[model samples]
Target: MADPAALSPLAELARRNDPDRFLCALFAPPAQREVLFLLIAFNHELARARQAASNSMTALIRLQWWRDAVEEAATSAAPRRHEVATPLAAALREGRLDAATLQGMIDAREVEMEEDIPSLPALLAYLRGSAGGFAVAAGRTLGAGPEHLAGLQALGAAFGMAALLRGIPAQAMQGRSLLPADLLAERNLTPSDAARDPRQPGTAEVVRQLAGEGQRLLAEGRARAKGLPRAALAAALPARLAARDLARLASTANDPAQPPPPRGLGDRVAVIWGGLVGRG
Candidate 1:
């Protein structure tokens, strides 16, 4: 068992590092939580390392270190200066994780060191690599059923996009825009308008529309994920909550006490276990 205090770094760093991500990690088991944190930390560390040393060669060197660290994580022996590998290696020994998803995550981050996504398709793909990876890692820990796992992936994708959407204003403030150029062009909006702090009035409508679409997808994810076993509860609840939240945000207004849920955790557990196992 991991010391509660030891897991604090994982939890605290996850909270400050990325709240959207930290929420996802919370759905995962503590034993496996470290893997999610290490993946984010590795990406963050690599990004910082690249920025510290200016020039293409320096960035490559740092990325190569990450690559080697990934390779070393596959072996019984550790490599030189492998910070992320420590947790990864422990995960490997305990049969808690593997290398494919983790390596894919590092590779995605390396590609992001210089490139900027300008379209929704590209942004969606990148978001998948970021939060999707975390979802899969957590799913592995929970051993969720396929239906639930699919739902988790979809919900994770939505959460990832939400994070990107939240960062849009910040990016525009820095003179960079991640809004899909096509979306902007089709809507007849300019970067200057989007760059406006809190955005212009019309921007609110656009945000609402995007969130509305996200809510629809989240709805689909939850509907498909309702039949998983009790073991999957830890991960499934968070995804369900996320789906419902995006749905609420997309809607005009909502009652806080009892939000609408097609089939929520409490109800699902009641239907599945209550009738079958609990006679009273």
Candidate 2:
């Protein structure tokens, strides 16, 4: 068994930096929860690579390092020295993970590091690669079989799209845009306009459209929930929050420039309830 003490840093990282996933992990089997936290913490590190680096090249270099680390951990008996890498190696060694899917998640971050906005198809592909890939890996970790992979991927894409919509304000503030360029063009809008003022004409429509798409995807995933492996349910728990937030975003009449408020106590309760019912 791995040292519990050595895994503490990863647990703390997930709790502090990715509370949504941290909460979702609480619903997982106790023995598997730590590994889930380790996985999510690794994701957080990858997702923040751009902001943490000095430039795009630096970000690429950082991502490459993680890519190499994951590959090494997948094939080697010895563990890496870093905090995230160590537990991650242990998880991989257990033989429950798909290293290719995890590698795809890392590669997806490359799109985020670029200034150019992708088309809608390209954007969805990126989400499917990063978020969808994460979902598949998490489901696998939860003992889901090969048959459950498609459902997990759909669930992950739904959650990812909702997350992207939720992040618009913050991404805009950083002068980054995740909204598809074609959609923006259709609205006679530009990425700069969104960055400068998200409340401008047609922006709400763009948000509404994306949120609606997310909700649709969420519903589609939920339709297949009953067929998912029982253990996989906990890994999908965050979908409840994603559904709630997407609905809220779709209906908000206030400035879209503002970040959505944090999930409140009632929202948390709903998430737990949804998880318990296997509806998420």
Candidate 3:
């Protein structure tokens, strides 16, 4: 990791916008750390596209630009000249990254465009493609072999699910909902209903169900992450943070609107300990 006093612009961006992954990247070699930030920056850009653009049409246009950029990076020596795009292209040219994996990250955002998730399975697929895809990319950059990819992906998904749970209240307040429609339906609720009042019994139950799934994924990820190489394990460190958040959420009666306070010191310690021990 770069010195805290002399972070590169990309490193600073990751540190501010993605603290969990940023902490994990600190465990990687210096060269790999820079490349990991490139992926982090790219993912951040893709993540904000929907909010940045004026409409869904504009968002699709922006996402398509990324798709085209990824294609160019994969196929040619020179890709687009944007900050994140240029570095991403370099990673692609160096064989540390691939177009399909990056494309899958973009494809997963299509679900975000929908007003409501259709089912728990659909939400899982979206998280796997977006967050899981990102971890796989980072693991590859950190020199992980094929055998470690699945575990890395699962760890990433666990983090993603936990994150979504934390953000539910904010999303609902904005007239958006990430709760799956079918899950809500089982309790005689709709996404809009949940959005209007996430603390209702039905919505709370859905949150618990989601939390349970996150715990299962976290356990599975940790199990599979056993014996992973040290560098590769860095990419799975977010699972540690996820486990912490899930435990807190469960204790709060799975209330989507009542997130636990941010655990800055605990987060840093958890990532550091997990890194040193090569455990997610």
Give the alpha-carbon lDDT of every model: 0.54, 0.80, 0.84
Q: Given candidate 2, what's the lDDT at residue 66?
A: 87
Candidate 1 Cα RMSD after full superposition onto the native fold (Å): 7.2
Off by over 4 Å in 1: 1-8, 19-64, 80-83, 110-116, 145-147, 190-198, 201-206, 234-241, 244-280
**Which number leads on lDDT?**
3
User: Given candidate 3, what's the lDDT at residue 244?
Assistant: 91
Per-residue lDDT tens digits of candidate 1, residues 1-280? 1244655664556556654444444444456566667655654665456456666578778777767776776676754544555665676566666567666655655544543445657655665565555565566666765556666665556765554454554555554444555455556765455654435544455555656655654665566666655444444444444444455545544321222344346534433342244110
Clashes of each: 0, 0, 0
122 Cα displacement, candidate 2 (Å): 1.0
> Top TM-score: which candidate number?
3
**How do these models rank on lDDT, best leading?**
3, 2, 1
lDDT of 2: 0.80
Candidate 2, residues 113-227, lDDT tens digits: the string is 8775658788778877888888888888898777777767777888888888888799887887788877888999877777778887678788888888888777776666557
lDDT winner between candidates 2 and 3: 3
Off by over 4 Å in 3: 1-4, 252-254
Return whichever of 1 and 2 wins on lDDT: 2
